[model samples]
Target chain A: MSGTSAPATAHGPHHAGPYNPAKGRLGMWLFICTEVLLFGGLFLLYAVYRYRYAEAFHAASGLLDRLFGTANTIVLITSSLTVVLAIFEFERGKPTRARNYLLFTLLCGLAFLVIKSFEWGAKFEHGLYPNAPHLMSMGFGEILYFGLYFTMTGLHAIHVIVGMSVLFVAWRRIGKGTLMRTRPAFLENGGLFWHLVDVIWIFLFPLFYLIS
Target chain B: MAETAAHAGAYGEGPYFNPETVKPGPAGWLTTTNHKRIGVMYLSLIATFFSVAVILGLLMRIELMYPGQQIMSAKVFNAMFTLHGVIQIFLVVIPGIPTIFGNFSLPTLIGANDMAFPKLNLFTFYLFVAGAALAIGSCFTGGGAPDTGWTFYVPFSLKTAVNVPLATFAVFVLGMSSILTGVNIVSTVHTLRAPGMDFGKMPLSVWGLYSTAWVQILATPIIGITMLLIVVERIFGIGVFDPTKGGDPLLYQHLFWIYSHPAVYIMILPAMGIMSDLFPVFSRKNIFGYKMIAFSSLAIASVGSLVWGHHMYVNGQSDTAGIIFSLLTFLVAVPSAIKVVNWLATMYKGSIRVEAPFLYALSFVWLFTIGGLTGMFLGGLSTDVPLHDTYFVVGHFHYIIFGGTGFGIFAALYYWFPKLTGRMYEKRFAIVAWLTTFVGFNVFYFPYFVMGWQGMPRRYFDFPAKFTELQVVSSIGSYIMVIGIAMIIGNLLRGAKKGEKAPDNPWQGATLDWSLPSPAPLENWDVPPTVTRGPYEFNHSEDDK
Candidate 1:
């Protein structure tokens, strides 16, 4: 691992030899890009379905709590900022401060999940489970629209839970002062994953709560 | 003074092992970014999954022993087939050789100290485990496991009563893990090779993984996306593939195959690379056309992508698409044939040792040749009409996957177990296991070809009395294959604990993996190694007897 470090070059002409963190990050980014494409296919399905059942989707969109959706959006965006700041704090060698911000980010993730569960609870109370034969009484397009809304959002919620766990790990490591400090790769990687979860919500919020 | 000494930390002792530990122990495994450790974890877990699916496969054969459902209900049968397909494809075949062997050894083969991103490598392992948990969790969910097959084709997939969403989500996560590993490997090979190790000097194993890496990076997304869309459709009544919503069902097939087609080569090309490595070492000769074998891997990966359309040929695709896919599929075969020819030529007029790895490799040539030729039979439109959805297709792919890739994996395992474990297996038992596997494999699958020709459809728990005899033969073959697998497990597990100590370069191979101390150092290479010769140069060894 010891070699001529790439001259402390700031974004130097993309070093061709030896390991580069920039290249590693770019590789991770490219990987995330593939994820986007993977998720894009499902979005394509969402778009097609939305177009076909616009009336029903619009009606189902009405059933969602826009206030809670908007609140969760703000919570996620704020948490993303908090996570980015934690990275900056770690970069500045303030491990204790970084730990606090990471903890905050974790709390925000938890809050979002809590809100989502309540929202899901309400839907379950209404017997909105997917493919419920009784859902046909809700209108054909509405039945299909709510089905997708529940599925997409449900998957996204699972992602939120996963993201929270990742952030929690970072938080604990920062608290212990044993986090790899020479490079803030863990924070950065966790940040990347968190942003992906955030980005998924950016798509899901509109599809499920604002499609009309 | 004594109390202070009791609390005093030793140079090596700690409450827990940090990533810095190079020695083999529990701590080294948990947090180590060493590619080899990560690779071992991948291979070990995947082997467990493989064993489970193999049992399921045998059960399937057993169930078909009688005309009607004897061992299980129709529902259980459906779940069995679905579980078998899903588990083997994602949990075993996809990661079997690549993440396990490729991740562990590719860096070593190219003389790199570690992957370009070691942390990412560890992360991929965790992701794989998480995905696996989700998949296993689906089995216990209220509705039962997903039964739409591995492809999870729409309509049925969307309407399935099982926890299909959970399983699909698991696959989606696993695919991401695969993509990240691909990115890590590709970049590592591009930027991490030793100074003298040019792309041409890179071993064919590296080449094979490098080729398959892009398929994982690029092709996996299509399936990832398709699986997600199905989840969306099922939950939201998304009309993308629903006829009621003006969506086209056929498009699902299109996107699914776009990724799944190239996935076939992803499963095989690494095995070919393993064969290429073994061929020259055992023959005590330089590969006859090293460059050809290396480039053929690329040729196979590139052409393999364009041929996904072949899987959809009989599913109402346009004739032009069919023709294009057929021709390209046929074109991909040429490189494979070139590889076989070159491997044969390497063995000609030279010292040949039928060692365990080489025996497996040799069987790969025979089995893969049959698998490859039968693939041609399925690729052509005229011939495919009769074989599509029949046992013939099942037999053909099983040959390629189980016989070819699976055997190739065993070859690599036997070849590298020494380097990984610093121990040698019992030679006679290994050969017996290989022969048993080889013989039992052909017996189990070859008859399916005959039944396939007789218009017997696959995924059936019940069959006509006429097909009963062949079913019996196939079931017997399954038992034989099971014993063969048992022999392998016994040989390897016992050998790891009690086998003879292996020399660093037991096979007198020239690859960088053997350049280090046996079982590898904690850092893989204590000092970065410089490549001095091409990977296949047999006589370049100064210590060769």
Candidate 2:
């Protein structure tokens, strides 16, 4: 995986010749284009519905816990920081340090999700979730408002899980010494995916919890 | 990672790379990372599903033969068409040309031995199978078949009693597969091209795929998220696109067209690439306006992605937006028109080979031109008002997708029959099949333009008595077309198994593929290949730099 191609195993024929990190990097970026557009669709919805029901969206924003929203945002941003640091350690030949950084980043991802669940649970207890009696009473605008809130944030949560899974794989590969300084694509691409997850939340934070 | 010692020793030195010789049976093929074997795998699946979709089309046409239900009830008709649209679009055309031809020929086209990510390529094939299974499963698992069209328009999609969630999830899975394939192709082209073969020297098909990969990566995800949201809406009644809860169905139209329109390009651009390769080889001439044709592919991908709004003109989108979309839609025709002109110019005065592949390519140009020209009428804001959702729309797309892309697939099969299987098909049967298909295709789709101009709506199982005669004619035409399709499939399949051995450079093609030995090896080139000249330097007849 360094300069040479990975061997063909019982897995059948493999791409011969030397391994190229740029190829992996480019492939990951193209994948990020899809993830961005996937989230872009949701953001377009937020823009449309927000334009339609400005007053109701603003009032619904007031109901959400800014403390918890701000806390989760900080947790995600810190996780992005750790991912950056993980790659930095990979660059410095300190695989153990990089591994620890990745573990921390993953833990931050979990913490972000745990805090997200509490926020969602609190809303659920207030009968604020979609199709609940009180949310139905909240009328069309608020129901739609909460519906998008859960949809976008819930999707963001799923992405958080995926990013963690990517980091986990990177962590395992790095410890196996296949994804080190000479072959850092696995770790580097994992960092790229994590950054995407973090950036999507930055937009989601302002749109739902902040702009609201 | 230091496997050069063992890899170089074992690479390309053993088996002939044909299935007959290269580790045979399901064990070797099912887990293959070799691009060639993966291509054959895709071909088998595509052929099977194509037959299923063709049958659905025939049945629907038969049902619409008379005024009232001829063979199926209105409900069954709805389900059939829905499945027909879903299967043909996702399982066939969208992935059709790219995965099969791209997998089989791209590395050779670019002079690389394997894709940049081989394991990813095999994983992508499995992803396709998984998505396809779930999509077909949606038809019979819970409730009844999915009645909402492939678009899965909102409100109805959410409220439908059928298994909408499972169906939409299948599309999500499919979209993921498409996105990964796109990513792999882009990376392969960027990093794996033979040394010295820059973008300018690369085959135009590589250009088409490079552009298509970008479209697949960027546009497919909108539909992926949209489909996922459909499932979300179904399970939670989120009312995101449900009108009763203040959600706008128009938003659904916007989101759907955002991907579906570009998807049409995903279906055709590669076919156009095939046309690019075909015109030169058959003419034995340098491809005219090579740079223009190459840039136009990029032009098509970029300009084509923005024209999705053209589909939403009558769906309550603002007139300013509609007019803007209409203008952009018109712009897309320019690049398409340029490519067509260049192809004709490529064949203008050359010594032309009147072969079956050439016949299919000729039909593609003629039919695709009509499809594009008719698209202009529908692109105009005023003209679209009448044609929207009419049989006109249906006919226009069928011309592009089936006539254009489908024929391109046939041409590729005929043209590469020798390279792929080391055999030449019975040429007479191929031409007969092509003639039958050409005649049958026009007969089947052309009447829809007339009926649609006369104001016949689409997706309706029963038509008025006034429309009965043309409907019957269309049904008969489809029967002829299906026979031709079957013959085309049968001839090539029979040839692959038992035809005469084909000579290298069977078409005397000037491309790198012709330089490859018959039944091109499992990993493509025996050693690393480096291309020096332009792809269509037929006079030189060599890509060796």
Candidate 3:
């Protein structure tokens, strides 16, 4: 894909006119704000339910594997650093290095997802999945807690996968020289999105895994 | 080349000036990224949905005509009303003015060739179509259409065997579409304004869209997540909103209204902006308090988000919460009132032209005033309890949304018909349609206010004998409204086909849109326009017809 010398504009007809980096960045920020609100609603629900059933929520939080959660949090924070470095390298005219950092970010994303799958697998083995017979028999607050746990983390993991795919695309584009420093909005937006995913995880980790 | 010449001959302009050739043919329409084509597509899509929803609404009224399962079973009646609410709110009013006129005119009004992100604009359109399809498709699947009403309040939404998940998912998609459009519009306003077109110099309509875009971006995600939660609860039996699972239904209401309340501004702000532009145009005067009108739109969007709790007045929330929400609701009204006053003051002593568009705008003022004032009744703690679920609440909202935004659309369509179609509608028929619709609308909805005040609960299949007379009256009024709406649609279609060709500047306006040829060219302007005057500068010598 990178070998094609299609003059970059062949990326699509939508890229008409001079690219406005500021507009692209502003649009990304606005989108990030929206993602915050999206997760904010779920957080509001957690807060309300946690307040209502404090003891059960603590017990439910205890059921989560903090080691896995902590490891995933560190992995996400490392990924955030890699994405930032990727942007730094791209802007500093080091496309190969930026691509390598993006690759590392993508790896971290995979690692996070693999760890998440293992954790979820263990929960499923315990029959703690939402509305499972075992979960249905649990205390109401515990049921609600696990319900929110899966939903929130599941949504975050989807974001991680999406962010990884975006980084992969940016990496490929940078290799093709289509996403050079002159046309860096695509890479910048990808980095911003990855950071948002990390920031959301930062919130989710303490709320869901470490609250107890 | 042949197609180009054919359009040139038809439109009296060559390929160099035609906007339609950005793409050509049926395939072109589906794939076209031109804002004009997308806008026209939205008009058609919205009209189709509006027609279906209107017909469904008429069916509901027909059943209420005689009461007690007159034409359909109670279950069918529930489905009809639910679909009606969903369709009208999501597919019609919410997207009404902004997607239609805003898409068509915003870039031109600001002297941009197209939206900042034209591709994203087209994507938003497709999202709308996909959402509408899913919403309508739900009717044929999984125990038929959802009967849980548009709100889809918990406990019931969770228990319904109907396709609540599909419907809610449709809403989620639609919300995404609304947010993306909002982002596109806001970005356009910020980055695409013509040289010298400062924010203050922008048309009030632009300001209206700007404010609405903020609401759409900020408020829509809450509802998007809320709807997803509902889908989650339905599919996974998560107790996020289910009472059996330690969920509080009130949380759903809170989350729903948090977005839904500000969504009211999303529906009406652009319409209000249209009025701001129209009053100055028809009155042949500069808008009174232009800054106030512009600022009020922003104020409305800001304050509107905080008052969602007003919708929960009867939901057993704390009185302190209700009082706070009620006060904030009343506070939101202040900005709305300021706009009304400014519009009226603009028309106070000017040379007013009573055109069809102007007539619709005038009716919007009257109807919206009634709507707004009645809203005060619903906003106050003392009065809302009696009117909470009554027909009064229904009447108030229809007056605001249907009467306000709906007529705002009619006004914009008539005002821009010549510009949009490059043809003049029959003036007399246009006025006739307006008068009939105006009269019929008041007659139809006013009775609901009376009946609601007299204690007729909404969404009921049957009522007592004492309520029979007013129900029949309201039904008759709806029939008249149907005829009037039919006439309006017929006039526009016929006008586009055979009406007289419109001149470039029919209204002698000063906005950048008026500077363009009717059926504005593909790039909107061959050369980017520079603005040296305000959007409502009526005193300019060239505009002094």
Candidate 4:
């Protein structure tokens, strides 16, 4: 088996040139699986504490502003749609349209983070910050509830920032005409990540805000 | 041999010896994306950590040579044992086989050029280094070294002012590295196989690494989040684990063991795969039950995850939970037994080679059986309650981890030395090392079983006068084992530079790796090979039998 063709590089031509859409999708999906497990651990904690302190968890959930939570949920779901549209535009060979859609997706991500920070700030104003002096006066379950809330949402917000940055990079590449329809794996992977961030928010919104 | 040479030189100036093709110079090695280079780098890093950890262990054993402290204070002893456990578990054993042999051999064994994500492979290597540096650096930073053991169990972990945050964060970084490597390997195994190399047709070692990658991906995240929670608790006084904050300490045990129990399989499975590959080759036979061995790896991964509760039996978990976990722990042993039986059966009527590698593999069977059978004793509710924190538990753990996986690693190192360096290690030195190590390993750990059974607790700086004899025996054994380990490392180092050149197929094995040059080229195959038979097809060749 010698000298039949040029040697394949480490990333392999399957990924590097004329993207094998499937490999990119598979890698991203595998990454998404790890992300699920990451959040799954937090969910496990939530489930355990909620079971033990159902009343306190319910009371804590009621204290969270459902309107802001619902609004942020809508913002994230809308971003997921925009990112999907970005992929759709790229697939349709409209580079300019895809770039605009990506920009919109990034804006939606920013809006969600801004709203989330405001929500956290409101909780801090009400003395519900994790381990704050006021939380020590709250029941053990409530302390745990707020603890899980800040940790989980805080981690989710980090993902939103990361997802936004990935989209921003893709947006820049698209503008350079380098990430056109033919080379859309970068954009597709970015979309997949953004959608993952949105999906996690869907769960977080219900568990922390609407469960009660 | 001549025919082998023809195929070996078919790819000119092999990657192992050719500086240009393999990226010459220290800088090239630092930045290279070649999986083999990265694998060598991992082996070097692991070796360094293993040596340091082993020295710490020797010191600990010396401290326990008599009853009272021999060389260090109780505080120093505590930190020494803690750092030793942390380094050995996280840096050395857990990442040992997969990163070293898996990165080097998986592609070649499957007839591919390199891992699916080579740059990511290099990235994981650096992450491991950074994590290790952070862990080592914590010793020099605030409040002295972390005295909390590697498990970092509840209230103690939370209360310790010693740099628990830095140590825990180091583990978090290391866990992320493991997860990324897992993703890369799973993707590689799924997509990078040579044409006609179906899952069944892949070598058992690849199967081992593939199963292990899943464990790493699924189980590691729990630890990641757990460690983060600990960090949060430390910084914010969250009472998730601290009893003062209305947190249940048991929750920490539950979450820690969830990842760590399966982490045991993560440490052993790839090594198990190595034995699967070795047994057939040395026995000069096709593997007796290929499907059995292959499926057992996956079986162990799945079943092992559920047995995490076994570790919490004495922690006052519910009776039903304890019974269920004990049963699951027993269930995991079935798959392990299936693998051992298959290995022995593979050797049943074959012309077995008694080489250094095979000796280690054989020692693995004997030692692992001892390790596994003793594990059953601990899996039982009645037996574990009494032996839980005793020297018996420590003995059983060392037997399985060090004797089982550690020996498996030694076997792999010797077996692949020729392929890795294009030179044969001195066989006599290898055998002597194996003998001393085997004898020393048993001497070092076996008495712990007796002492433990006789009511000696573990992790203590001093023992009563009654426990002194066995402790001295174990300590002396450790010194012998250290010498043996040094010989093995020295032999390999010397072999790389001065030993005889190895042929492509030194052992006459029938795997794809043996089809290439002794040191495989940068991109493994000149043209990717299309598989025509399974990894072990010895029955078709008279010489192989």
Best by DockQ: 2
Go through the candidates in order and give each one's C-alpha lDDT: 0.81, 0.86, 0.87, 0.86
Task: Write candidate 4's Cα lDDT for B1-545 as tens digits.
Answer: 11233234446345654677655788778998777888999999999999999999999999999988689999999899999999999999999998999888888887777787777888999999999999999898979899988999989988887999989999999999999888888877776777667788888999999999999999998898899889988887767777776678898898899999999999999999999999999998889889989999999999999899998888989999999999999999999999999999999998888999999999999999999999999999999988998999899989999998999999999999888998899998899999999999999999999999998988899989988888899999999999999989999999999999988678887778887777766666544566667888876532353
Ranking by DockQ: 2, 4, 3, 1
Model 1 chain A worst lDDT run, 10 consecutive residues: A5-14
Give the per-residue lDDT digits (tens) of candidate 1, residues A1-54: 112212211111112234356655757676777767666666766776677778
Worst 10 residues of 4 chain B by lDDT: B1-10
Better of 1 and 4 by lDDT: 4
Q: Write the per-residue lDDT of candidate 2 for residues B414-437, one digit (tens) a residue.
A: 988887888889999999999998
What CA root-mean-square deviation does each model show from the true structure? 7.6, 4.0, 5.1, 3.3
Q: Write the per-residue lDDT of candidate 4 for residues A120-171, one digit (tens) a residue.
A: 8999899998678988898988988888898899899999999899999999
Clashes of each: 5, 0, 1, 0
Model 2 DockQ reads 0.44
The candidate that achieves the highest TM-score relative to the unseen native structure? 4
Off by over 4 Å in 4: A1-19, B1-13, B539-545
- CAPRI grade, predicted model 1: incorrect
Give me the TM-scores of chain B across the candidates. 0.95, 0.96, 0.96, 0.97
Q: How far off is residue B114 in model 2, in Å? A: 0.8
